[model samples]
Target: RIIEGYDGLGIVSTIDPGQGLVVVWVTPDTQDEVTHILHFFPRALNY
Candidate 1:
């Protein structure tokens, strides 16, 4: 659901959501933006 609003920022391709195995793909240019966005999550998801 997170990636739904931030389409160009990143993508989440997880075969099994229950396993908590979420694959996030972010390009080099989008790294800073991704990091900034993740900060709002209270470090719940760290790369």
Candidate 2:
């Protein structure tokens, strides 16, 4: 549930549903990068 919210951000390196834990690696270092990520994955932003 938690990771789903960050669907457009980055990769999920690790997850523990029981503990409600999630690790994400977002690499949007610049404005353009962030725009690209959101552009490519529009559904993620809606979530």
Find the candidate with the highest TM-score and give its number: 1
Clashes of 1: 0
Q: Write the per-residue lDDT of candidate 1 for residues 1-47, one digit (tens) a residue.
A: 66557879888788577877777788999889877877787547757
TM-score of 1: 0.70
Provide the TM-score for each candidate, comma-separated.
Answer: 0.70, 0.33
Best by lDDT: 1
Going through the candidates in the order shown, the clash numbers are: 0, 0
Task: Specify the poorest-scoring 10-residue window by lDDT in model 1.
Answer: 38-47
Candidate 2, position 28, lDDT? 49
Candidate 2: pairs in clash: none
C-alpha RMSD of each candidate structure in angstroms: 1.9, 7.4
